[model samples]
Target: MEYVKGKPYFCYCDGKIKQYRYLDKDIKCEILIIGGGIDGAIANYYLSKDFNVVLVDKGRLGMSCTACATALLEYQLDDFAEDLLKHMTEGEIVLAYKMGIDAKGKINNFIKTQGNYCNFALRPTFLYTNSFFSIKSIKKEYEFRIKNGFNCKIFDSNNSPFTFPLKCGIYAENGGGEFNPYLFTKQMIENSKNQNSIFENTNIVQLIKNDHGYIAVANFGEKIYCEKVIIATGFNWEVLGIDDLCERFITYSIVTSPLKDFTWFNKALIHDVESPYHYLRTLPDGRIIYGGEDTIFKEKPINENVSNKKYDKLEKDLFRLFPEIEGETKIEYKFCGCFGSTPNNLGLIGESKIDDDILLFISCGANGIINAMAGVDVIKDILLRKNNPLIPLFSP
Candidate 1:
């Protein structure tokens, strides 16, 4: 569906995984995951430990939307607790926030044990705004965090430690993380228990229901008989043939060439309160990865003309934020990829509405990777027929 466009930074990074063979023969398993992006990698990594799982991708793994992900693993939702109250209760909001924190911990633990090949590191999170209209909302979010016992410091213009202008903001110490998304996807897939079952360039042409389960026919006529299926194709939902899965958007990003002595307070993950807001962080290589400026995705193959304009806007925005590097730094990478958002800022991570046997592991919103990391447990609990408090929050 041409879900991604332009040269993505992460895809060109080191630690790329070796290619997997296509489906040359029929296969069978307890659960069959139909995508090899980061979402599918997380699902397979966790679920395969308990269930018989197989993962297949139509193209190379982590080369699509996963490559373009900004990888800002913050525990904060796309919307504040105040705004999410319309769709979720106070308790649900708190739980979702906690889930985000726990998800970050999970990634940390994974890196600790699996080795930090993805350049994973925990960093502080800075949510700020220069607009006076946003101060109240940021304060409300800060108050919510305080009420929920999530330690964070609220900053105003007088107390701000950042170089950029800020009327108000919230700073949570080590409340977020950063990593190479493509490498992390590879890490998860290589560490997964079903390593031998992973396949690439195997497109499932059709899913035929059978007495036991369903038969997934590959493009080459090979078949996979599985009791359950997971569709983790990111924002590309054409495989489902069911539109309106979620509100889709094309989020743009630009990476700057390494600056010799450029940095912000604690090198924290910084995001603004502006609608279709912007985010920035320093890479391990001293470069800056900045993104946002999202536009609704009405169709695929992301328009180059629109993308080019967005890139221009993003470059200008970056310069506006850090005028010191305006003339010195040059943008090295420009890319845009599709992502989905739900009303609750949570992912569609449970059973499909059409059939319970068909699961959806699509992680939406800004904190998608975090959502997927924690939501995998919800999926596992469902597979085990156990109760999970997060089921209602992330369920499709």
Candidate 2:
């Protein structure tokens, strides 16, 4: 399935990662990770530290859905805390937020230790709404955060820091991050311990269970005999042959040509509270990535005609937020890709329902990269036969 379409800005960036060869023979290991996107790279990077691990992908790593990710690593869910109460406890919601903050810290530490080659930066997050109806909800969410001891401030039209109109908004001083997703994926995979065990263009076609474990057969008839499997193929689940994992959607994004001396309030990661809402962030080069306007996925490749319309809408919306840029800059890139979402706004990152030995690393929702950063520990705990409190929230 074609999960991404158009010229993704990340893939076209200057930094090119090292390539890996396809599997030519059978192999054996304690754990085999299928799908070499950012999620897989994260899992392999941490898991390989203790296990005999091998990571493989059907195609090149971080060039599919990962290529198009806006990568707003925020410590907030797509839904508000009150709405998530229907599917999760208040404690779980708080825990998820804490996990997101922790994950952001981990990413910072990794960059500090490994060198900052991914253009990563810590940024505040601003979630706002101009609608009167959304004001109450935004206030409630802010109250929840303050009650939980989160450091943030509430804004209204009287005290709004942004030029755009705002009825109400929540600002977290240390709530989010932004980065070059493809480069971050490259850094993780390259720094992983099992470099010799990583392969690209190596499709795993079947998994045959045996008394000891299972044998994963490749498209070219090669095999991977392993004790466990981790599927991190983003929204492409052809290998699992199952469709009920989560609700899938195609999200559209557009990037603008750099504007001279233009910047938002603190360059904070921004999200609006509209249905199928929009998000925006600033790149190091002054270009803005604006995205959203999602549609349900129906097991079809992205339609160019529909994508064109979506791009047009996104461009207009971008102007709506920042009218000064409408005549100054034009869109330089347009792209869309599939993403999954669960009711709880968490990911399927634990043992699969089909088989206990087969684990899943499908990081879903808007903060997927953040979820994956924290979720690796859940997978690690499961492999170590330890109890993880977050397991139930992300159980597959």
Candidate 3:
């Protein structure tokens, strides 16, 4: 898939930091990771700690979907827990929610270990509903989360954030945060450099399964022999014939110039109950990044006119939510990227049904960063030949 168009702010901020040499020789390792995005980096970080690992990407690392990501590290799934209960048993739903929540903590801990280099900041999240009819459902969701001992509080319109038309809102404490995804991916790769080999501009053209393991042939005919192979290519997993696992869509986002007066409520990560909900966050430098005008994926190149219309909608919505910064804000960046959506809003992680020696760690959904963090532990346990309890929860 054509992952992104327009300048992704994070990429621009980081500039061209470093470059890796392309692969020119065949290599052998205990584990081979294809794709140098966030998932691949996380996998490399854990697997390299104890085994020989090789990570390769067709292009620059973290320049694809990872760079374009909004990077909201929240445990709140796109599908609420109360709604999931309609399809799954209470125990199943609770476990899934707990896993998501635990993923947030894991992410925090991992960031801490890395010296919090990714602009990691713990913040509150507000899931609100503007419609009166939606209030009851939102209240039910709030009650369900609270009943499960989650940190949540319900607020009526009278006490909700100013400028937000809220009938009710769920203020979740210690469940969400934001980070610089591009930096996180790069740091992970750098941290693993000692124990792992990274090959850039090397495409794995074919995979051959042998009796003992798998052989991945690169574009230049350089083969990688490994006991296990992992695919973390995001929406482009069609190269591995697993694109059908999740539906793809396009989402737009805009980053504004530093505002003179930031009037947003506590600068908390804010989202709504509406479909294609608008999400907004404030950077430390006083800039606001807002995203969420999503549509079904189309195979055409990014059209400037279409992108402008989407940006207009996003800008208009931003003004409606926070009219205080109307004239003061100027959009500095606008971009659109393909986002993979799963049925249950949880990431897909496990061994491939068709290929036994191959593992899949596709983080599909809004909680992708957190899911990827969770997946690191799961994949590590699998490599160690230990049973991961999350296998059944996030199974492919």
- Write the residue-wise lDDT of candidate 1 on 1-396 in tens digits: 487898999878877888888889988999999999999999999999989999999999888899999999998999989989999999999999889999999998999899999989899999999999999999999999999999999989899899888899999996999999999999999999887899999988788888888899999999999999999988877677877899999999999999998899999999998987999999999999999999999766689999999999999999999999988989999999899999999999999997888999999999999999998998998988999999999989
Model 1 clashing residue pairs (backbone): none
What digit string (tens of lDDT, one per residue) describes model 2 on residues 1-396?
Answer: 399899899888878769999999989999999999999999999999999999999989889999999999999999999999999999999999999999999999999999999999999999999999999999999999999988999989999989999899999999999999999999999999998999999998888998768899999999999999898988988788987799999999999998999998999999998987999999988899999999998857788898999999999888988898789999999999999999999999999989999999999999999999999999999999999889999997
| Predicted candidate 3, C-alpha RMSD | 1.7
Indicate the residue-level lDDT of 60 in model 1.
91
Query: What lDDT score goes with residue 224 in model 2?
Result: 94
User: How high is the CA lDDT of each candidate model?
Assistant: 0.92, 0.93, 0.81
* Stretches > 4 Å off in candidate 2: none
**All candidates: CA RMSD (Å):** 0.9, 0.8, 1.7
Summarize candidate 3's per-residue lDDT along 1-396 as a digit string, tens digits.
377888888877743526788889888888889999989988888878888889889999998889888888887788777777665666777776777778778777877787877787888888888888788888788888888888888878678765767888888877688888898887788878543389889999888988769899998899999999998888787558655777888889999999876746666788877877778888867899999988877665766687889999999998888788889879999998887877767677878877768888888888888888887777787777798777676677
Higher-scoring candidate on lDDT, 1 or 3: 1
Q: Give the TM-score of candidate 2.
A: 0.99
Could you tell me the TM-score of candidate 1?
A: 0.99
How far out, in Å, is residue 256 in model 2?
Answer: 0.4
Residue 374: error of model 1 in Å? 0.6
Task: Report residue 221 deviation for candidate 3 (angstroms).
Answer: 1.1
Ordered list by lDDT, greatest first: 2, 1, 3
